[model samples]
Target: MDSVLARALIEDPTEDGRLPLFLLFLAFLATFLITRTITRLIRAGKGPFRDRVAGGVHIHHAIPGIVLTIAGAFTSVAVDGSSPGAEIAAVLIGIGASLVLDEFALLLRLQDVYWEREGQLSVQVVSLTIAGLGLMAIGIDPLSDHTLSVGHLVIAINLPFHVAGVLMCVAKGKYSTASVGAFIPPVAWIGAIRLARPHSAWAKRHYSSEKRERAADRAHRFDDRYGRWGLNIEDLVAGKPTASPAVSGQEPSDPKGAA
Candidate 1:
Protein backbone atom coordinates (compact mmCIF):
# COMPACT_ATOMS: atom_id res chain seq x y z
CA MET A 1 0.00 0.00 0.00
CA ASP A 2 2.77 2.37 0.97
CA SER A 3 4.78 1.62 -2.14
CA VAL A 4 1.81 2.16 -4.44
CA LEU A 5 0.94 5.41 -2.69
CA ALA A 6 4.55 6.54 -2.90
CA ARG A 7 4.65 5.84 -6.62
CA ALA A 8 1.34 7.60 -7.24
CA LEU A 9 2.56 10.65 -5.41
CA ILE A 10 5.91 10.97 -7.20
CA GLU A 11 4.82 10.12 -10.77
CA ASP A 12 1.76 10.54 -12.96
CA PRO A 13 0.86 7.78 -15.44
CA THR A 14 -0.46 10.32 -17.95
CA GLU A 15 1.01 13.77 -18.35
CA ASP A 16 -1.95 15.24 -16.44
CA GLY A 17 -2.82 13.75 -13.03
CA ARG A 18 -6.39 12.66 -13.64
CA LEU A 19 -8.13 10.98 -10.73
CA PRO A 20 -9.69 8.14 -9.49
CA LEU A 21 -6.07 7.90 -8.50
CA PHE A 22 -5.78 4.36 -7.17
CA LEU A 23 -3.82 4.87 -3.97
CA LEU A 24 -5.47 8.08 -2.74
CA PHE A 25 -9.05 7.03 -3.42
CA LEU A 26 -8.87 3.74 -1.55
CA ALA A 27 -8.36 5.46 1.78
CA PHE A 28 -11.57 7.44 1.41
CA LEU A 29 -13.34 4.32 0.23
CA ALA A 30 -12.22 2.66 3.43
CA THR A 31 -13.31 5.60 5.56
CA PHE A 32 -16.79 5.67 4.04
CA LEU A 33 -17.24 1.92 4.29
CA ILE A 34 -16.21 1.85 7.91
CA THR A 35 -18.28 4.90 8.75
CA ARG A 36 -21.30 3.35 7.09
CA THR A 37 -20.85 0.01 8.80
CA ILE A 38 -20.52 1.56 12.21
CA THR A 39 -23.52 3.83 11.72
CA ARG A 40 -25.58 0.83 10.70
CA LEU A 41 -24.57 -1.08 13.80
CA ILE A 42 -25.36 1.88 15.98
CA ARG A 43 -28.78 2.34 14.44
CA ALA A 44 -29.63 -1.34 14.66
CA GLY A 45 -28.81 -1.28 18.37
CA LYS A 46 -26.13 -3.90 18.03
CA GLY A 47 -24.34 -5.29 21.09
CA PRO A 48 -22.35 -3.19 23.54
CA PHE A 49 -19.02 -4.52 22.29
CA ARG A 50 -19.86 -3.55 18.73
CA ASP A 51 -20.86 -0.12 19.92
CA ARG A 52 -17.58 0.31 21.81
CA VAL A 53 -15.56 -0.90 18.88
CA ALA A 54 -17.43 1.43 16.55
CA GLY A 55 -16.55 4.37 18.75
CA GLY A 56 -12.88 3.43 18.60
CA VAL A 57 -13.09 3.04 14.85
CA HIS A 58 -14.64 6.49 14.58
CA ILE A 59 -11.68 8.05 16.39
CA HIS A 60 -9.02 6.21 14.42
CA HIS A 61 -10.25 7.66 11.11
CA ALA A 62 -8.26 10.77 11.80
CA ILE A 63 -5.08 8.83 12.47
CA PRO A 64 -5.01 7.33 8.98
CA GLY A 65 -5.26 10.83 7.55
CA ILE A 66 -2.25 11.90 9.54
CA VAL A 67 -0.37 8.82 8.46
CA LEU A 68 -1.17 9.45 4.80
CA THR A 69 0.22 12.94 5.17
CA ILE A 70 3.39 11.69 6.79
CA ALA A 71 3.73 9.14 4.06
CA GLY A 72 3.43 11.86 1.44
CA ALA A 73 6.15 13.88 3.17
CA PHE A 74 8.52 10.93 3.23
CA THR A 75 7.65 10.00 -0.32
CA SER A 76 8.49 13.49 -1.50
CA VAL A 77 11.89 13.41 0.16
CA ALA A 78 12.67 9.93 -1.13
CA VAL A 79 11.59 10.69 -4.71
CA ASP A 80 13.41 13.95 -4.98
CA GLY A 81 16.52 12.65 -3.18
CA SER A 82 17.22 16.29 -2.31
CA SER A 83 14.88 19.16 -1.51
CA PRO A 84 14.39 21.47 -4.43
CA GLY A 85 13.54 24.93 -3.09
CA ALA A 86 10.18 24.99 -4.89
CA GLU A 87 9.13 21.53 -3.64
CA ILE A 88 10.08 22.40 -0.08
CA ALA A 89 8.14 25.64 -0.20
CA ALA A 90 5.19 23.91 -1.77
CA VAL A 91 5.12 21.30 0.98
CA LEU A 92 5.09 23.91 3.69
CA ILE A 93 2.37 25.92 1.98
CA GLY A 94 0.30 22.82 1.32
CA ILE A 95 0.48 21.77 4.95
CA GLY A 96 -0.53 25.22 6.13
CA ALA A 97 -3.48 25.38 3.76
CA SER A 98 -4.60 21.84 4.42
CA LEU A 99 -4.58 22.27 8.20
CA VAL A 100 -7.19 25.00 8.04
CA LEU A 101 -9.48 22.81 5.97
CA ASP A 102 -8.91 19.84 8.29
CA GLU A 103 -9.89 21.82 11.37
CA PHE A 104 -13.23 22.88 9.91
CA ALA A 105 -13.89 19.36 8.70
CA LEU A 106 -13.52 17.74 12.13
CA LEU A 107 -15.28 20.57 13.92
CA LEU A 108 -18.38 20.30 11.78
CA ARG A 109 -18.36 16.49 11.92
CA LEU A 110 -18.35 16.48 15.73
CA GLN A 111 -21.45 18.66 15.81
CA ASP A 112 -23.33 16.53 13.28
CA VAL A 113 -24.95 14.28 15.88
CA TYR A 114 -25.94 17.20 18.03
CA TRP A 115 -27.53 18.83 15.04
CA GLU A 116 -29.42 15.67 14.16
CA ARG A 117 -30.67 15.13 17.71
CA GLU A 118 -31.89 18.70 17.89
CA GLY A 119 -33.72 18.35 14.55
CA GLN A 120 -31.50 20.95 13.01
CA LEU A 121 -31.24 19.59 9.50
CA SER A 122 -29.30 22.49 8.10
CA VAL A 123 -26.53 22.20 10.64
CA GLN A 124 -26.39 18.46 10.17
CA VAL A 125 -25.99 18.87 6.41
CA VAL A 126 -23.26 21.43 6.79
CA SER A 127 -21.35 19.41 9.32
CA LEU A 128 -21.66 16.18 7.39
CA THR A 129 -20.70 17.77 4.08
CA ILE A 130 -17.60 19.43 5.47
CA ALA A 131 -16.42 16.25 7.06
CA GLY A 132 -17.26 14.30 3.96
CA LEU A 133 -15.27 16.59 1.69
CA GLY A 134 -12.36 16.59 4.08
CA LEU A 135 -12.42 12.83 4.30
CA MET A 136 -12.71 12.57 0.54
CA ALA A 137 -9.83 14.94 -0.07
CA ILE A 138 -7.67 12.98 2.30
CA GLY A 139 -8.37 9.96 0.13
CA ILE A 140 -7.15 11.84 -2.93
CA ASP A 141 -3.38 11.87 -3.24
CA PRO A 142 -2.62 15.53 -3.92
CA LEU A 143 1.15 15.22 -3.76
CA SER A 144 1.25 13.47 -7.12
CA ASP A 145 -0.23 13.85 -10.60
CA HIS A 146 -0.68 17.50 -11.46
CA THR A 147 -3.74 16.83 -13.68
CA LEU A 148 -5.69 15.21 -10.88
CA SER A 149 -4.72 18.12 -8.71
CA VAL A 150 -7.91 19.95 -9.58
CA GLY A 151 -9.95 17.09 -8.21
CA HIS A 152 -8.04 17.48 -4.98
CA LEU A 153 -8.75 21.20 -5.15
CA VAL A 154 -12.42 20.40 -5.44
CA ILE A 155 -12.57 19.69 -1.72
CA ALA A 156 -11.25 23.12 -0.82
CA ILE A 157 -13.36 24.81 -3.43
CA ASN A 158 -16.59 23.38 -2.10
CA LEU A 159 -15.80 24.49 1.43
CA PRO A 160 -17.91 27.60 1.03
CA PHE A 161 -20.99 25.44 0.83
CA HIS A 162 -20.20 24.23 4.33
CA VAL A 163 -19.62 27.75 5.55
CA ALA A 164 -22.98 28.76 4.19
CA GLY A 165 -24.59 25.80 5.86
CA VAL A 166 -23.12 26.79 9.22
CA LEU A 167 -24.42 30.31 8.81
CA MET A 168 -27.86 28.91 8.14
CA CYS A 169 -27.65 26.89 11.37
CA VAL A 170 -26.80 29.97 13.37
CA ALA A 171 -29.67 31.81 11.74
CA LYS A 172 -32.16 29.14 12.78
CA GLY A 173 -31.43 29.87 16.44
CA LYS A 174 -31.68 26.20 17.40
CA TYR A 175 -28.07 25.26 18.09
CA SER A 176 -26.61 25.11 21.57
CA THR A 177 -24.10 27.95 21.56
CA ALA A 178 -21.94 26.36 24.22
CA SER A 179 -21.55 23.26 22.08
CA VAL A 180 -20.35 25.39 19.19
CA GLY A 181 -17.67 26.94 21.37
CA ALA A 182 -16.53 23.55 22.59
CA PHE A 183 -16.16 22.45 18.97
CA ILE A 184 -13.21 24.72 18.37
CA PRO A 185 -10.40 22.51 19.64
CA PRO A 186 -10.50 19.66 17.12
CA VAL A 187 -10.82 22.09 14.28
CA ALA A 188 -7.94 24.11 15.67
CA TRP A 189 -5.88 20.96 15.98
CA ILE A 190 -6.40 20.36 12.28
CA GLY A 191 -4.59 23.62 11.73
CA ALA A 192 -2.15 23.12 14.59
CA ILE A 193 -0.93 19.76 13.40
CA ARG A 194 -0.32 21.12 9.92
CA LEU A 195 1.37 24.34 10.92
CA ALA A 196 3.46 24.83 14.02
CA ARG A 197 2.65 21.12 13.68
CA PRO A 198 2.71 19.25 16.99
CA HIS A 199 0.52 16.18 16.74
CA SER A 200 0.26 14.01 19.88
CA ALA A 201 -0.13 16.02 23.06
CA TRP A 202 -2.19 18.88 21.72
CA ALA A 203 -4.38 16.78 19.46
CA LYS A 204 -5.20 14.30 22.23
CA ARG A 205 -5.93 17.02 24.75
CA HIS A 206 -8.13 19.00 22.41
CA TYR A 207 -10.03 16.00 21.10
CA SER A 208 -10.63 14.66 24.63
CA SER A 209 -11.76 18.00 26.04
CA GLU A 210 -14.15 18.58 23.15
CA LYS A 211 -15.64 15.13 23.51
CA ARG A 212 -16.12 15.43 27.27
CA GLU A 213 -17.64 18.88 27.13
CA ARG A 214 -20.06 17.94 24.36
CA ALA A 215 -21.16 14.81 26.21
CA ALA A 216 -21.75 16.67 29.47
CA ASP A 217 -23.65 19.41 27.72
CA ARG A 218 -25.84 16.90 25.89
CA ALA A 219 -26.74 15.10 29.13
CA HIS A 220 -27.45 18.36 30.89
CA ARG A 221 -29.77 19.48 28.13
CA PHE A 222 -31.55 16.14 27.96
CA ASP A 223 -32.22 16.12 31.70
CA ASP A 224 -33.32 19.72 31.78
CA ARG A 225 -35.84 19.13 29.04
CA TYR A 226 -37.29 15.76 30.10
CA GLY A 227 -36.54 15.03 33.77
CA ARG A 228 -39.81 16.43 35.12
CA TRP A 229 -41.97 14.42 32.70
CA GLY A 230 -41.08 11.10 34.34
CA LEU A 231 -41.60 12.17 37.97
CA ASN A 232 -43.90 10.20 40.34
CA ILE A 233 -44.58 13.09 42.74
CA GLU A 234 -48.31 13.02 42.00
CA ASP A 235 -48.66 9.58 43.62
CA LEU A 236 -46.97 10.77 46.81
CA VAL A 237 -49.15 13.87 47.21
CA ALA A 238 -52.01 13.30 49.72
CA GLY A 239 -54.77 15.35 48.02
CA LYS A 240 -53.40 17.05 44.92
CA PRO A 241 -55.78 17.62 42.03
CA THR A 242 -55.59 14.88 39.38
CA ALA A 243 -57.77 16.52 36.73
CA SER A 244 -57.45 19.10 34.04
CA PRO A 245 -57.41 22.85 34.65
CA ALA A 246 -61.01 23.12 33.39
CA VAL A 247 -62.21 20.42 35.77
CA SER A 248 -60.50 22.06 38.75
CA GLY A 249 -62.01 25.43 37.78
CA GLN A 250 -65.56 23.95 37.89
CA GLU A 251 -65.08 22.18 41.25
CA PRO A 252 -66.70 23.77 44.28
CA SER A 253 -64.41 25.84 46.49
CA ASP A 254 -63.87 25.06 50.17
CA PRO A 255 -66.08 27.11 52.52
CA LYS A 256 -63.07 28.47 54.32
CA GLY A 257 -60.00 29.89 52.55
CA ALA A 258 -58.31 26.44 53.01
CA ALA A 259 -58.54 23.21 51.02
Candidate 2:
Protein backbone atom coordinates (compact mmCIF):
# COMPACT_ATOMS: atom_id res chain seq x y z
CA MET A 1 0.00 0.00 0.00
CA ASP A 2 2.81 2.37 0.87
CA SER A 3 4.61 1.67 -2.39
CA VAL A 4 1.41 2.05 -4.40
CA LEU A 5 0.66 5.37 -2.74
CA ALA A 6 4.21 6.54 -3.32
CA ARG A 7 3.91 5.63 -7.00
CA ALA A 8 0.66 7.51 -7.25
CA LEU A 9 2.17 10.59 -5.64
CA ILE A 10 4.94 10.71 -8.22
CA GLU A 11 2.62 10.18 -11.16
CA ASP A 12 2.19 13.26 -13.37
CA PRO A 13 1.03 12.04 -16.74
CA THR A 14 0.22 15.46 -18.15
CA GLU A 15 3.26 16.99 -16.42
CA ASP A 16 1.12 19.94 -15.34
CA GLY A 17 2.57 19.96 -11.80
CA ARG A 18 -0.19 18.06 -10.02
CA LEU A 19 2.23 15.77 -8.15
CA PRO A 20 3.86 18.58 -6.22
CA LEU A 21 0.44 20.02 -5.50
CA PHE A 22 -0.79 16.70 -4.10
CA LEU A 23 2.27 16.43 -1.85
CA LEU A 24 1.69 20.00 -0.75
CA PHE A 25 -1.91 19.19 0.15
CA LEU A 26 -0.95 16.13 2.20
CA ALA A 27 1.90 17.96 3.94
CA PHE A 28 -0.35 20.95 4.67
CA LEU A 29 -3.06 18.77 6.21
CA ALA A 30 -0.59 16.85 8.38
CA THR A 31 1.29 19.96 9.47
CA PHE A 32 -1.89 21.83 10.43
CA LEU A 33 -3.26 18.88 12.44
CA ILE A 34 0.03 18.37 14.24
CA THR A 35 0.48 22.08 14.88
CA ARG A 36 -3.05 22.36 16.28
CA THR A 37 -2.45 19.36 18.53
CA ILE A 38 0.77 20.80 19.89
CA THR A 39 -0.80 24.22 20.44
CA ARG A 40 -3.75 22.68 22.28
CA LEU A 41 -1.42 20.72 24.55
CA ILE A 42 0.59 23.87 25.21
CA ARG A 43 -2.62 25.74 25.97
CA ALA A 44 -3.74 23.07 28.45
CA GLY A 45 -0.33 23.13 30.19
CA LYS A 46 -0.35 19.35 29.86
CA GLY A 47 3.06 19.09 28.20
CA PRO A 48 6.64 20.37 28.37
CA PHE A 49 5.99 22.29 25.19
CA ARG A 50 5.60 26.05 25.50
CA ASP A 51 4.81 28.88 23.13
CA ARG A 52 7.97 30.35 21.63
CA VAL A 53 9.01 33.58 23.29
CA ALA A 54 12.12 35.65 22.62
CA GLY A 55 13.29 38.70 24.47
CA GLY A 56 9.82 39.47 25.86
CA VAL A 57 8.28 38.99 22.40
CA HIS A 58 5.88 36.15 21.72
CA ILE A 59 7.21 34.56 18.50
CA HIS A 60 4.17 33.59 16.51
CA HIS A 61 4.46 30.65 14.08
CA ALA A 62 3.42 32.92 11.22
CA ILE A 63 6.89 34.43 11.04
CA PRO A 64 8.64 31.13 10.33
CA GLY A 65 5.73 30.14 8.07
CA ILE A 66 6.21 33.24 5.98
CA VAL A 67 9.94 32.59 5.60
CA LEU A 68 9.44 28.96 4.62
CA THR A 69 6.68 29.73 2.14
CA ILE A 70 8.77 32.42 0.42
CA ALA A 71 11.83 30.17 0.29
CA GLY A 72 9.87 27.17 -1.02
CA ALA A 73 7.93 29.17 -3.60
CA PHE A 74 11.09 30.65 -5.03
CA THR A 75 12.82 27.28 -5.15
CA SER A 76 9.77 25.61 -6.69
CA VAL A 77 9.66 28.25 -9.38
CA ALA A 78 13.38 27.97 -10.10
CA VAL A 79 13.69 24.18 -10.17
CA ASP A 80 12.91 21.87 -13.10
CA GLY A 81 9.22 20.97 -12.96
CA SER A 82 9.83 17.20 -12.70
CA SER A 83 12.81 17.38 -10.37
CA PRO A 84 12.92 16.07 -6.79
CA GLY A 85 13.70 19.67 -5.85
CA ALA A 86 10.16 20.64 -6.82
CA GLU A 87 8.67 17.98 -4.51
CA ILE A 88 10.87 19.09 -1.59
CA ALA A 89 9.91 22.69 -2.21
CA ALA A 90 6.25 21.68 -2.20
CA VAL A 91 6.59 20.12 1.27
CA LEU A 92 8.32 23.23 2.58
CA ILE A 93 5.60 25.46 1.15
CA GLY A 94 2.89 23.25 2.60
CA ILE A 95 4.34 23.27 6.14
CA GLY A 96 4.88 27.00 5.99
CA ALA A 97 1.36 27.69 4.72
CA SER A 98 -0.26 25.60 7.45
CA LEU A 99 1.53 27.58 10.14
CA VAL A 100 0.65 30.89 8.54
CA LEU A 101 -2.99 29.99 7.94
CA ASP A 102 -3.39 28.52 11.44
CA GLU A 103 -2.95 32.07 12.71
CA PHE A 104 -4.58 33.89 9.79
CA ALA A 105 -6.94 35.94 11.97
CA LEU A 106 -3.89 37.42 13.68
CA LEU A 107 -2.54 38.58 10.33
CA LEU A 108 -5.94 39.90 9.35
CA ARG A 109 -6.37 42.00 12.53
CA LEU A 110 -2.68 42.69 13.35
CA GLN A 111 -3.21 41.33 16.86
CA ASP A 112 -3.26 38.12 18.82
CA VAL A 113 -6.86 36.94 18.58
CA TYR A 114 -5.92 33.25 18.54
CA TRP A 115 -8.21 32.15 21.36
CA GLU A 116 -11.10 34.50 20.65
CA ARG A 117 -14.27 34.25 18.60
CA GLU A 118 -12.32 35.93 15.80
CA GLY A 119 -9.89 33.00 15.91
CA GLN A 120 -12.58 30.88 14.30
CA LEU A 121 -11.86 32.73 11.06
CA SER A 122 -8.45 31.08 10.93
CA VAL A 123 -9.98 27.60 11.11
CA GLN A 124 -12.55 28.53 8.47
CA VAL A 125 -9.84 29.83 6.17
CA VAL A 126 -7.66 26.79 6.70
CA SER A 127 -10.59 24.46 6.05
CA LEU A 128 -11.43 26.20 2.80
CA THR A 129 -7.79 26.20 1.69
CA ILE A 130 -7.40 22.50 2.36
CA ALA A 131 -10.66 21.61 0.60
CA GLY A 132 -9.76 23.71 -2.44
CA LEU A 133 -6.25 22.28 -2.60
CA GLY A 134 -7.56 18.74 -2.24
CA LEU A 135 -9.91 19.24 -5.15
CA MET A 136 -7.19 20.71 -7.36
CA ALA A 137 -4.73 18.00 -6.33
CA ILE A 138 -7.19 15.40 -7.59
CA GLY A 139 -6.98 17.09 -11.03
CA ILE A 140 -10.47 18.58 -11.05
CA ASP A 141 -10.38 21.37 -13.62
CA PRO A 142 -11.87 24.58 -12.29
CA LEU A 143 -14.95 26.47 -13.56
CA SER A 144 -16.67 24.47 -16.26
CA ASP A 145 -14.38 21.47 -15.60
CA HIS A 146 -13.60 21.13 -19.29
CA THR A 147 -11.69 22.80 -22.07
CA LEU A 148 -13.73 25.42 -23.92
CA SER A 149 -15.25 24.39 -27.25
CA VAL A 150 -18.03 25.60 -29.50
CA GLY A 151 -20.26 22.79 -28.20
CA HIS A 152 -19.78 24.15 -24.65
CA LEU A 153 -21.19 27.63 -25.43
CA VAL A 154 -23.98 26.94 -22.94
CA ILE A 155 -21.39 26.76 -20.14
CA ALA A 156 -20.03 30.17 -21.14
CA ILE A 157 -23.54 31.59 -21.26
CA ASN A 158 -24.40 30.14 -17.85
CA LEU A 159 -21.12 31.33 -16.28
CA PRO A 160 -22.58 34.67 -15.21
CA PHE A 161 -25.52 32.90 -13.50
CA HIS A 162 -23.07 30.80 -11.50
CA VAL A 163 -21.07 33.92 -10.61
CA ALA A 164 -24.27 35.59 -9.45
CA GLY A 165 -25.08 32.62 -7.24
CA VAL A 166 -21.62 32.78 -5.71
CA LEU A 167 -22.02 36.51 -5.13
CA MET A 168 -25.40 35.99 -3.45
CA CYS A 169 -23.89 33.30 -1.21
CA VAL A 170 -21.22 35.75 -0.10
CA ALA A 171 -23.88 38.43 0.47
CA LYS A 172 -25.83 35.91 2.55
CA GLY A 173 -22.74 35.44 4.73
CA LYS A 174 -22.52 31.74 4.02
CA TYR A 175 -18.82 32.27 3.44
CA SER A 176 -17.78 28.65 3.70
CA THR A 177 -20.55 27.68 1.32
CA ALA A 178 -19.51 30.48 -0.99
CA SER A 179 -15.91 29.32 -1.03
CA VAL A 180 -16.91 25.81 -2.03
CA GLY A 181 -19.60 27.01 -4.39
CA ALA A 182 -17.05 29.12 -6.23
CA PHE A 183 -15.90 25.83 -7.74
CA ILE A 184 -19.09 23.78 -7.47
CA PRO A 185 -22.10 25.43 -9.13
CA PRO A 186 -24.80 23.38 -7.39
CA VAL A 187 -23.66 24.49 -3.96
CA ALA A 188 -23.79 28.14 -5.09
CA TRP A 189 -27.34 27.68 -6.32
CA ILE A 190 -28.41 26.09 -3.05
CA GLY A 191 -26.83 28.85 -1.00
CA ALA A 192 -28.32 31.50 -3.29
CA ILE A 193 -31.85 30.12 -3.02
CA ARG A 194 -31.61 29.72 0.77
CA LEU A 195 -32.51 32.47 3.23
CA ALA A 196 -29.56 34.63 4.25
CA ARG A 197 -28.28 34.42 7.80
CA PRO A 198 -30.21 36.79 10.01
CA HIS A 199 -27.20 39.03 10.66
CA SER A 200 -25.86 38.83 7.12
CA ALA A 201 -25.51 41.94 4.99
CA TRP A 202 -28.19 40.66 2.62
CA ALA A 203 -30.67 40.06 5.40
CA LYS A 204 -29.91 43.35 7.19
CA ARG A 205 -30.37 45.36 4.01
CA HIS A 206 -33.04 43.46 2.09
CA TYR A 207 -35.08 41.27 4.44
CA SER A 208 -38.35 42.69 5.72
CA SER A 209 -39.23 42.42 9.45
CA GLU A 210 -41.12 39.17 8.90
CA LYS A 211 -38.38 37.81 6.64
CA ARG A 212 -35.77 38.77 9.17
CA GLU A 213 -37.65 36.85 11.87
CA ARG A 214 -37.91 33.82 9.61
CA ALA A 215 -34.20 34.04 8.77
CA ALA A 216 -33.35 34.21 12.46
CA ASP A 217 -35.46 31.15 13.16
CA ARG A 218 -33.80 29.23 10.35
CA ALA A 219 -30.33 30.34 11.47
CA HIS A 220 -31.04 29.19 15.03
CA ARG A 221 -32.17 25.77 13.83
CA PHE A 222 -29.17 25.41 11.54
CA ASP A 223 -26.78 26.37 14.31
CA ASP A 224 -28.43 23.92 16.67
CA ARG A 225 -28.32 21.11 14.14
CA TYR A 226 -25.01 21.56 12.32
CA GLY A 227 -23.09 24.70 13.15
CA ARG A 228 -22.63 23.78 16.80
CA TRP A 229 -21.38 20.35 15.83
CA GLY A 230 -18.73 21.92 13.60
CA LEU A 231 -17.73 24.26 16.41
CA ASN A 232 -17.46 21.34 18.84
CA ILE A 233 -15.14 19.50 16.45
CA GLU A 234 -13.10 22.67 15.97
CA ASP A 235 -12.78 23.06 19.74
CA LEU A 236 -11.73 19.43 20.08
CA VAL A 237 -9.04 19.81 17.45
CA ALA A 238 -7.97 23.36 18.24
CA GLY A 239 -8.12 24.63 21.82
CA LYS A 240 -11.46 25.69 23.22
CA PRO A 241 -11.88 29.48 23.24
CA THR A 242 -12.22 31.56 26.39
CA ALA A 243 -15.57 33.17 27.34
CA SER A 244 -14.12 36.53 26.37
CA PRO A 245 -10.99 37.63 24.56
CA ALA A 246 -8.01 38.45 26.71
CA VAL A 247 -7.30 42.11 27.14
CA SER A 248 -3.61 42.97 27.48
CA GLY A 249 -3.76 43.61 31.25
CA GLN A 250 -6.85 41.58 32.15
CA GLU A 251 -5.41 38.07 31.63
CA PRO A 252 -1.71 38.65 31.39
CA SER A 253 -1.00 35.29 32.93
CA ASP A 254 -3.31 33.45 30.54
CA PRO A 255 -1.31 31.62 27.84
CA LYS A 256 -4.13 32.07 25.33
CA GLY A 257 -3.19 35.70 24.92
CA ALA A 258 0.45 34.76 24.39
CA ALA A 259 -0.35 33.42 20.92
TM-score of each model, in listed order: 0.29, 0.68
What overall lDDT goes with each candidate model? Answer: 0.35, 0.72
| Candidate 1 residue lDDT tens string, 120-230 | 222223334335433433344444435455555653554455444333323322123212312332332232222110112222334466654553454345446642331
Best model per lDDT: 2
The TM-score obtained by model 2 is 0.68
- Weakest ten-residue segment in model 1 by summed lDDT: 250-259
Report the Cα RMSD per candidate: 19.7, 7.5
194, model 1: CA deviation in Å? 36
Candidate 1, residue 175: the lDDT equals: 29
RMSD of 1: 19.7
